[model samples]
Target: MGTEPDIILETRQLSKTFLGFTAVDSVDLKIQRGHIHALIGPNGAGKTTCFNLLTKFLEPSQGQIFFDGREITRDKPAEIARKGIIRSFQISAVFPQLTVLDNVRIALQRATGLSFHFWRSEASLRHLDGRAMELLAEVDLADFASQMTVNLPYGRKRALEIATTLAMEPSLMLLDEPTQGMGHEDVDRVTRLIKQVSAGRTILMVEHNMKVVSSIADRITVLARGAVLAEGDYAAVSNNPAVMEAYMGTTQGELEGIHA
Candidate 1:
């Protein structure tokens, strides 16, 4: 509910090393509360590594992460999610056999801390069902709520993933390639949905699609070889000589500006 100027996530001298190799090197990142910040780089640029460190999946070799002004460098992944940070994976992570409503209900139950109890009446879960349906509606998947998740098309599966993440009631969402393997239309659909979802929550994503990044990113951060290459609006980074050379394999004069 805060403006984009409010800092929602921060990393201080964050670093991750594997054996003798450094994946992320003393990276400092600041994400605003309600802006859609995009992280882009060539494959193996360590965008995913930075995400893992922020989400607490991987411990930093040195440095710390702060969320909502509280230090969370030592917290576990689930503990971080409990503190209102949720992430969506690149692959479709849904219960294939379960109905869409059931998938969302599971997330709702987790968010609300309601255990599955057969002996007790499910009256408490009725509230969770209402909330789950609300999230499905937000993602425009309410009509498919009773259908098996596997029956939906690939694009809708991604939508269901977003809905499941929304059921968690997160303030900041880290999405890893929301439109990773989609057709043109599907990509556009998910792109619009990402923009829609970013209104009330902070979104930090790693995207390979330059067009998509140029389209929806309010701010862009370019990383190459585990270090910050450029950080600015789309046009600034896209036009920067260093950024173009590092990722586009071109000189600054060869590439045109990325128009939003």
Candidate 2:
């Protein structure tokens, strides 16, 4: 018999209400271990809100979130991260004055909880350089290590963010719009990097790029107006009438952008 899919992340009636506005209505989501799951919806679909709720950036108005069978609905953000969940933002958050190498090194230190050594001499941190470089190389950023993070092109900066997150060795990675703005080449590079890194990890992403979603997603969940509109593989979701109608008035180019 085929082995059952191992679910690493689950949400039961998860929601978030802002004042009188329900940013995210009652929703349920399941992400299998080792799978790349995509959450897609048109604008104002509560995709981002759901992401924030799951990562503990915002508290849910109701419902529960589970990771590895542990209830983390009330866990602090840092506590959730230490439980092996790491989130990558749409805008790569890197220290402008810090060199690319130091950017990754800082992430490595954070992952290892070595932030307490802030007053230590630079030499004392040399041991971390090896692992940092290894992570940089894994994300194709080793050659740019010594350069200031602010000097990187838009795409490389995003790659650097992924490298930093990798330093945490996350079991479940949450990515918000991995390829929002980019040329064809950068998109291709990050896509390949994500696929390569998912060998042993689960990735749940909120993405607007349909091409990237269809190409890499193992399963997909579609949200519309704070609710799940559809759920399935690419072929199944791309053809759903509700999903199609929800994209009402979307230009053909926009539709084509996703169909790819």
Candidate 3:
């Protein structure tokens, strides 16, 4: 007997529309537990729209969303987040004035949903310091805990964002373009960090960088014209003519680079 496929996230007929225009059609996607799933498409492929729908940043026009076998199509963003679905924001999310450790501490505070008005004291926040630093060290920011967030380099700043998100201790992480606008070294660094973090968590990401997706994705879903074009492993999707044709010419030579 074979073990069944463990799906952590499933969407049935999920869709979104803007007036007369359909941004995301009736699409179904499944992400297994402990897998790195990548959603890729051209600029107009509705990839980001699907992500917004999943994250509750934009509600779907019609569909059912199930996270860990629980229906969350009607749940609010905060409610869904509390259920262990957390999305990592872009690099600008960190507190510029606060130190790295302090930034993570605030995230942990927010995750706990503490009644800030009830108990207000630096002493109350003391116990969170060690846990915050542990999260920073998980992302390799242990040495820079005392540095102001704005003083960090662009890549480390992004790492701080990841650390802050980690403070939530999410079971499922949704990352949108985690390595966007990064140079070669930063991209490599963040890629490694992502792999490290995905050890026990399920990751669903909307990414344009084919190289990063190819390197880390356990399964790839290709979207085109607001719908899924292909779904499979990297080897399968990378070789699919439909997927290649979708990115041909419009993706600025990304397909050719993937071939190389």
Candidate 4:
């Protein structure tokens, strides 16, 4: 096989263009199984664009994508999702009107092929409560299980989102800025939650918070102007001149400060 068994996802010369502007250039990415891989870049570095391409929200203009040694370049979003590639958006995606546990139960319904079965009696879905509670506990949200999702604190909402994603039993979870717009306490809390939930699963995240990346990312790929600028553990990428320059005003001292 051309792909290493350890690589759960791979992109070969992946590219995306809008009109004449190249959003994501020919970039190759490989995410190792059971690792937290961070994709970081400056503003307009095409980080989100690349995530969109991987999840098949936007078809690539050129190149190929592989998931678990299988070419998925042409797979539709739902198809890839069924293949265990679950993506969580930058914003918390949950049903505000539903209880926290119910949000996760809805995702669990997919595995039972009852996702569209809203007319079913409430008892039919109660069977999912135990597993849903387990998932919520995994994210430290079990105490809020009965609370309405809309009233959850921002960080808890993100945690609930993670619990729902886990309900799908994703082999590879793509988290897009899971910690954005959070206060320091929430940032640290979610950061720990991400690490906690990453056991036995691979995570590929687009994150701007260096502290989170430094603490948990097993590998980091730095993107600049739609191209790979650096690839390494936090220590390597943070000290690279190009990566430092890409951040412009972010002095090397500041980078070093987050080097946990």
Candidate 5:
């Protein structure tokens, strides 16, 4: 018999509600190891809620979360993060006043599990600077290492955020709209950076840009209202008339309708 696929992350009957409102309802998701999975949907489709549940930001009202074969549904956010699951929000989550090197240095220190040495000279902290520089180079931000994070372009800032997150050495990274407000050029740069960063790590992203979704997603899941509308390869989703009509709109709907 063929061996069962090892699931890196799994959620069964995942759901969330606020008072009497249902944001996400009975959503089941599975993600394999070392793949880039993209979640696409219109606004108010519970994409953010899903992200929150996965990262333990909000406890699921009626579901279970498993990571690497262990249950994580009830775990605290920090506990989950320490177990190699890190998340980045839609907004830029960085120290705007700090230099690029300083930003990355702080991340490295956290990843090294050294949070108590907050007052020590980072330069003299046992290869912290060297490690920080290496991560910067990995994310193509070495050239801007000494520059203030706020001074860099939007695209560069996004890249730096990824570099900082990488310092945590996450096994799976959940990104919520990493390119939400970026212009065309910056969007393209973030896409390329995501591909480069996914070399050995698994990534789950909620993206609205169809172009970015088509370019880098190894698998796609379309969400609508509050559940999985469709899940398949690029062509399958791109050709599904219902998916196109519901999520991608009339343009994609027309194209995919014919193809379907």
Candidate 6:
């Protein structure tokens, strides 16, 4: 028997076009298992388009996507999700009115194929609480398990989203702009939380915060004008002249200051 591949997910010549304009131009990506890979680019650089193609939210105009050594370019979004690629925050995964623990419980229920059974007794669902709390603890939201999810702070809401995503038991977690808007403390908390939860899982994140990327990413792929411009560890990518010029323009000094 063959050994499992080191690449958990990969894209070959992935391209997408709209109305004769290309959004993602022949982008190829290889995401190694058990590593946090960051996809970063300046605004309008096709990062979101690339993510949509990978998740099957938008069909690729050309190229192929593979997960776990299987071609999945033709799979639907739900199909890819079931294949262990879960995109968090692309859609809100938590219910505002539900308690934090209940939010996770719902996700667990979905994963177990019991999501449609609303008629199931509350007592039967209580069994999911322990596991739900564990997921909450993984994102450092254990103490807020009983609180209404809507009442939690913004940063904590993001954490709850992570917990709910975890309940789906994803092997590859796609986090879109995990720290898009936040204060220093919240960013630090979520950054640490992401690193902590990445113990056995592979994470592919599109993050704008250089500090967050430098701190936790095992590899970085820099995009420019809808194509790959550079790929390396934080240090190598940050120091690349092409990346510095394309991503930060003339402000290369600011780009060099970002360090893990």
Candidate maximizing lDDT = 4
Better of 1 and 2 by lDDT: 2
Please give the CA lDDT of all the candidate structures.
0.83, 0.85, 0.85, 0.90, 0.83, 0.88
* Clash count per candidate: 0, 0, 0, 0, 0, 0
Off by over 4 Å in 6: 1-4, 90-92, 250-252, 256-260
Least well predicted 10-residue stretch by lDDT in candidate 1? 251-260
Give the residue spans of candidate 1 off by over 4 A.
Answer: 1-5, 90-92, 115-124, 251-260
Q: Whose TM-score is greatest here? A: 4
Clashing pairs in 5: none
Please write out the lDDT profile of model 1 over residues 1-260, one tens digit for every residue: 22234888988889999999999988988997789999988777899999999988899999988888888999998889888889875212688998999888877766656634424455756767778888888888999999999899999999999998887778888999888889989989999999988888899999887788888999988888898888999889877878877755665444432321
Cα-based RMSD of candidate 2:
3.2
Q: Residue 175 CA error for candidate 1 (Å)?
A: 0.3
lDDT of 4 at 185: 96
**Candidate 5 per-residue C-alpha lDDT over 1-260 given as tens digits, one digit per residue, 9 for 90 to 100:** 22226679988899898997888888988888899999887678888899998888898889888888888889998899888899964222788999999887778877767744778885566577788889899889999988998899988988998988888888999887888799989988899999999998999999878788888999988788888888987889887777767754666544332311
Pairs in clash, predicted candidate 1: none
TM-score of 4: 0.96
Candidate 1 CA-lDDT value: 0.83
Q: lDDT tens string, model 4, 7-101? A: 99999999999999998999999999999999998889999999999999999999999999999999999899889999975223699999998
Candidate 6 residue-wise lDDT, 1-260, digit = tens: 22248998988899999999999999989999999999998888899999999999999999988888889999999898898999996434678998988888888888899987878888999999999888888998899988998899889999988988888889999999887778889999999999999999999999888889989999999988899999999989887889878855645568744421
